[model samples]
Every structure is written in structure tokens, then in C-alpha cells.
Target: MTVMELSNLSVTLRRRDVIRDVSLSVGKGEFIGLIGPNGAGKTTLMRAALGLIPFVGNSSLAAMPLAERAMAVAWMPQQREIAWPVTVETLVMLGRTPHVGALASPTDHDRSQVDAAIRWMGLDDMRQRAATRLSGGEQARVLIARALAQDTPFVMADEPVAGLDPAHQISTMQTFARLAEQGKSSLVSLHDLGLAARHCTRLVLMSEGRLIADGCPAHVLTPERLAEVFGISAWYQDTEQGPVCQPLEVIR
Candidate 1:
């Protein structure tokens, strides 16, 4: 089943187009990676999909209208420096916002989901710690836990591993892979080419408001395409571990 659909979608910022004529259909349990250079409309496309920005064209989540799509789609933006002193558990609980009533308090079920998410993200020990006190990697996991607590069938994460170390980065990627295998469609924007190629089942490459490539890692992420779209000389090879990408040098 199609979990998310965007057709002829266009988004503009400051009167300039950021995403244009982009269309995609994401199926259930699919793990997709959105990749591009900085300011390549990867984040813009994600924002449009989540209805966070004004977009021209059609976008639907589970065939529902934009306003009603929140019930089924959950989003976690790039991790930023959060100042609030809320506890880690409380922060994850915020994911329940879409499910709870405006005036109602969290029920036992809500608490259960929050606990489960914390455990799922391996954050059980830090449940009572202040969110602002955790390390960069821990905070990233906490945010992901919040998204999991949302329990939506689909999730969209923008730069989900911006500041983490290599170990944490790979761990988080594996977590997303497991989530997709468990019947949740997950779309993640990643700048690390090798990580995206290694983990994502499908790749969506965008640039200058255009969908440049979309296919399996081997077919779409070629040296020619990387040089053309990413402006870098690179090569992708297979090893015993998995696919590896080496950026030779700047093409210029």
C-alpha cells in the first residue's frame, strides 16, 4: 500500500522555487533516503510532505487531506540545540500530541506508549534525565523515541544524524531500518552518502528543486551521476561488508 504520495509538488521560499514538479509514491515498510547537497531542496521537499510549509500541488498521507494527515504521519526535524529543561521522558511524551484531545490529559495507554518508545530507543536509563543534559547522540535518540511514540504508520526525518559520532550514526540508521522492516514507511534525509547507500532500500536524489534520480543504490548513485549532480568525483564499490562509496576529489 502507498503510505505517502506527492504529485507535481512545488515549494517556494522568498519568491524563489525550492522544490518543483517533484512527485513520489512511498510504499508501506519502505526505507527511503533523500540525498542532495546543501540547499538542494531535500529539506524543502520533506517540509512540503509534512505540510510544514505552503506548497503548490497535491500531497496526501494515507490518501487523507493535508490538514488531516498528521494523524498518520509523524516528523522529526534535524536535531537542534534544545533549551527547555524538560526530562527525556517528557520530551518523548510530546509525540502523543496528535492522538490526545486538546483539553485531555494523557491516559494509561499514552504513558505505556511513551515507555515503550523510550525502551525501544535504548533510552530507558535516561528517562528521568533532563533532555538538555544529554549528549548529542543521546538527544538524537530521544527525539527518535518521541517520533516512535507517535505510533504513526509513516515517519519523515530531516538530517536525523547531523551531529552524532560514527558509531551512533550507524546505530540510528539501523534503528530506522528495523522500523521499516516492522511495517512502517520511513523517509530520512541524509548527507552521508555512504550511510544512505548502505542502509536505504531506495534512494531519492534531488537538486535545484528537481528530482534527479530515484532507484536502487547501485543504479542511481553512479560516478557519472554523482559528478553531475553532486559536483564531486566518486566511485561506489561492493565489499564483503557492503557497498562503499569513495569520493576521489573535487571534479574541478
Candidate 2:
């Protein structure tokens, strides 16, 4: 089933088109990695889909009422700076806001959902720690856990794993992959081509505000496309571990 849909989507900011005519669909049990070079409109496209920016297009998620939209898609933006001193669990519990009502307190089900999300992110031990005291990577995971706690049908994240070390990075990607297995959809923008290849069910390659390619990792990360869009040569192959793309060098 299609949980998110966009048709002829375009976004212009300050008289410059940052996201051109692009159409895409995200369905149940799919993990989509939105890959592109910087300034290629990955962020703009996501923001537009979430109705965080003005756009000219049809977006299933963006067209919903604000309250209804919150229940339909969980948004994890690129920013990870947490200045509040709230405990990690308390922070994550915020995800239940949409369901709890503005004047209501969290119910038992809400707490359980937050707990489940915390476990999913391997953050149980840090539940009581102040979010502001954690390292950047840990904070990132906490933020992801908050989104997971939201329990939306679809998730849209921008560069969700930027500050993590290798182990945490793989673990974070695995979290999204697992979500797909549970019949949830996620669209995450990623620069790490290898992780994108290894974990994503599909990839949407963008360049200069338009989609250049869209398919399975093996098909989307083609040598010619990589060299042309990314300006690099990569050695790519499938392993039992998953597909891997190692950059050999920049194209001259």
C-alpha cells in the first residue's frame, strides 16, 4: 500500500528552484534512501514532502491536516542539537504528543510505546541520562528513538546518521531496515553510499533538484551513474553481509 505519494513536486526558494519536478512514492515495508550530492535538493524535497516548505505539487502526506499529518508521518530532520536538560526517556516520550492530546497526560500505552522505541535504538541504559549530556552520536540515536516512538505509518529523515561512529552507524541503519520488515516505510537521506547500498530497499538518486535514478541499490549505484553524478569510481558487489560500494577514486 502506498503510504506516501508525490507527483510533479517542485519547490522554489528566493526565486531559485531548489527542488524541480519530481515524483516519487513510498509504500509499506519499504526503506528508501534519498541520495544526492550537497545542493542537489535532498533536504528540500523532504521538507516539501513534509509540508515544511512551500511547494507546487501533490503530496499525500503534505496535503493532510496538521494534526492528521502528525499521525501519518514521523519527521526526523537534520538538526541534532539538544539543549534541554530533560532525561532521555522524557524526551522520547514527547513523540506521543499527537496521540495524547494537548491537554491530556500520557497513558500507559504511550509509555510502553516510548519504552519499545528506546529498546529498538539500544538506548535503554541511557533512559535516565540528561539528553544534553550525551555525545553527539548518542544524541542522534536518542532523537531517532523519539521518532520511532511516534509509531507513524511512515518516517522521513534527513541525514539521520551523520555524526555516528561505524558501529553505531551500522546499528542505526539496521534499525530502519528492521522497521521496513515490520511493515513501516522510511525515507532517509544519506551520503554514505555503502550504507545506502547495504540496507536500503530502494534508492532515489537526485541531482540539481531532479531525480536522476531510482531503483534497487545495485541498479541505482551503477558505475556510470556514480562517476557522473558523484564524480567518483566505486567498486561495488553483493556480499552475504549486503551490497557494498567502496569508492576507488574521484573521476578526473
lDDT of 2 at 185: 94
Q: For residues 1-252, could you state the per-residue lDDT of candidate 2 as single tens digits?
A: 999999999999999999889999899999999999999999999999988889998999888999999999999999887879999999999999899987889999999999999998899899999999999999999999999999998999999999999999999999999999999999999999999999999999999999999999999999999999999999999999889989899886
Q: How many residue pairs clash in each candidate?
A: 0, 0
- The alpha-carbon lDDT assigned to residue 49 of candidate 2 equals 90
The global Cα lDDT (0 to 1) of model 1 is 0.88
RMSD over all Cα atoms, model 2: 0.8
- lDDT, candidates in the order shown: 0.88, 0.94
The TM-score, computed over Cα atoms with residue i paired to residue i, of candidate 2 is 0.98
lDDT of 1 by residue, 41-66 (tens): 98889888777788988888534664
Model 2 residue 148 CA deviation (Å) reads: 0.3
Runs of candidate 2 with Cα error greater than 4 angstroms are none
Q: Which residue runs of candidate 1 sit more than 4 Å off their true CA positions?
A: 62-67, 79-83, 103-105
